[model samples]
Target: MTTALKLVIFDVDGTLVDSQGDIVAAMAHAFDRAGHPAPAREATLGIVGLSLDAAFPRLAPELPAEMHGAMVEWYKEAYVELRSRAGAAASSPLYPYALETLTALHAQPETLLGVATGKSRRGLDKLFEAHDLGRFFVTSQVADHHPSKPHPAMLRAALAETGVEAHDAVMIGDTTYDRDMALAAGVPFIGVSWGYHDADDLTGAAAILRDFRELPEVLTTIREAAA
Candidate 1:
């Protein structure tokens, strides 16, 4: 009998790449452009996994709700401006062993990789292209196509696209948003420690990883437990 496909869906920004500095900077720029105080760094980073519309309001609740859309637009422009500067990508480095971990997982015949990120399609594309990492994903669900994290739409679409059952898939990320989404979608979640949010913030995840190198073993453990 053919083995069931194992789908490992990943969160991009804080999980696969360390884009917090850029994200916070862009958010600060947006708030500044709106003539409001920039959110604290912790507050800005706290919303890493959420879509801009959902995140902006939380970051600047004092501002008028109608201004949230403009904030998002300003944030996009600021982020694009930041990315255009030389060394911006270098400053936002991927965590240790990120590519190695993905490469190891991709090597498995039964494993199919997917990305479910709050990043816009254009942003995700640039990231994949910059790192030459586009080949790793068999499917990708971005903010352009779905609601924010903690909503099961992206994961559901990924499962449908790959024909993988929820039980045969795992969501790997670094935030409570990812955990909640997986919980809602009936998929197991594995959290990573070295991201914007604290490891404790991911209490709802099935397992929280301290290192990128731990991912393969964690995935194996999850698969075995489900068996």
Candidate 2:
């Protein structure tokens, strides 16, 4: 009767942090520095969890290849500025009880934890260090090298890095892209209600969690089922 899940992967931005203000502000700065007008919040929000290659084209349409590179760099610079401004406060503080929940999960033996995020490696690294969460994860797949959410490349990378099979893993995310990636990978998903994606998009999730407080319990059931 034991379920077989052994590894857990999490999406960063909206799933882990409410990085909206900084993201919107920095994206706007990128456009400004590139001399293109800033895209509105709606458009930026729509592109939040996509890979840079995918997101940039959406953010800076019709630009030459060189300009696309420049705009991406511009975005990085602006994001850094934004991250710096938020300093330690930038991370979407885990939804209520998130830390307590993660701590409980980490205490269980044989469980490997990892990150699958749309954030750049540098960005995720900074946030991890700032939050003193650097030790919790074994694998980190950033947007720099992966295809992005809804694509499953990052999720696949994380699984490969951790040496876990899709059937033996679970992905927790806040967007449909994350959930879809999980499904595509043949892994179960735990969709978060408070993240940027709409709840209606959570229809495909294995289960939907209303808050971080529910995480430990939800995961425990999954783990037990897989046991």
Candidate 3:
């Protein structure tokens, strides 16, 4: 019997790349440019998987709604400047074992890789280009084109684009938003402990991975159980 294809979707921030330094810095710069205090580092990290519009409100609920748009633009500008100054690869290095795991999965003919990220398309493209990651993902759904994460829109779009059923797909991410998004889309979720969120908050994940090297075995387990 022919094996059914499996789709593996990854979240960019916190999961694939350790981008907290740049994220926190850009957020601070934006808040400073807006003449407001930056949110706490932990607070900013907590909202890592959300779109800028959704994220700014959570970080600064006291700000008038009208100011949020300008803040988003400021953050984007600061982020771009920081990436340019630090060099793309240095600003957002992939997590340990991430490249190896991606290579292994890409080699498996029955498995297809995709991305469902809170990063804008331009940001994701930059990271992919910097890391030579454009070849690994067959489909990439970005916040620029879809609703912020935890809404399931990105995952649903990935499923449609790849022609993979929800049950045959898995989402690997580091935040509660990722878990909830996968749940909303009826896809299995694997949480990574190394990301921005605390591991305890990743409740209800099918599995939690402390290292990316464990991903292949975990995927095998999920796939067999689904079969």
Candidate 4:
């Protein structure tokens, strides 16, 4: 019998890439430019999977609501500047084994890779270009066209774009938002320990990976169980 195709969706920041340095630096720049104190690094990282509008409100609830739009723009400008200065690859390097795992998975005929990220299209494009990762993904969903994560819209779009059923797909991420988003989408979730969120917080994940090298085996196990 032919094996059913599997869709593996990934969250970009924290999961695939270690972008915390640039993220924190950009947040500080935005807050400084906006004449507000920067949020604690922990507070900023806690909102990694959220869109800029959603993130600013959480990070600085004391700021007036009307100022969020400008802050978002400022953050975008700061992030772009940082990427340009440091180069995107240096600003947000991939985690160890990330490229190898992606290459291995992309070689599989019965598997498809995709991205469902809170990152804007422009940001995602820069990362892909810097890392030469654009070819690996079959579907890419960004916050520019969807509601913030934990709302299920991005993953749902990924599924529709790939024509993959929820049952045959899995989400790998490093945050509670990703876990919650996968749950809301009725897809299995795999958490990563190396990302921003504490591993203990990934409450409902089907499995949590400590190393990217373990991913192929985990995917195989999930597929076998479903079969």
- How badly does each model clash, as a count of residue pairs? 0, 8, 0, 0
Number of clashing residue pairs, candidate 4:
0
lDDT of each: 0.90, 0.79, 0.94, 0.94
**Residue pairs in steric clash, candidate 2?**
2-226, 2-227, 3-225, 3-226, 3-227, 4-226, 17-92, 18-92
Give per-model TM-scores.
0.97, 0.89, 0.99, 0.98
Tens-place lDDT per residue, model 1, 95-200, is 7899998999899999999999999999888888778789999999999989998899999999999999999999999888999999999999999888878988
The segments of candidate 3 whose C-alpha lies over 4 angstroms from its true place after superposition are none
lDDT by residue for model 4 (1-227), tens:
89777899999999999999989998998899889999999999999999898999988888898888889998899889989999999999999999999999999999999999999999999999999999999999999999998899999999998889999999999999999999999999999999999999999888999999999999889888987
- After superposition on all CA atoms, what RMSD does each candidate show versus the true structure? 1.1, 2.4, 0.7, 0.8
Best TM-score among the predictions, by candidate number: 3
Ranking by lDDT: 3, 4, 1, 2
Task: Give the alpha carbon lDDT tens digit for every residue of 61-88 in model 2.
Answer: 7887787777778777877876776584
Give candidate 4's error at residue 183 in angstroms. Answer: 0.2
Candidate 4 local lDDT, residue 90: 97
Q: lDDT per residue, candidate 3, 1-227, as tens digits?
A: 89788899999999999989999999999899889988999999999999999999999999998898899999999999999998889999999999999999999999999999989999999999999999999999999988898999999999999899999999999999999999999999999999999989999999999999999999989888877
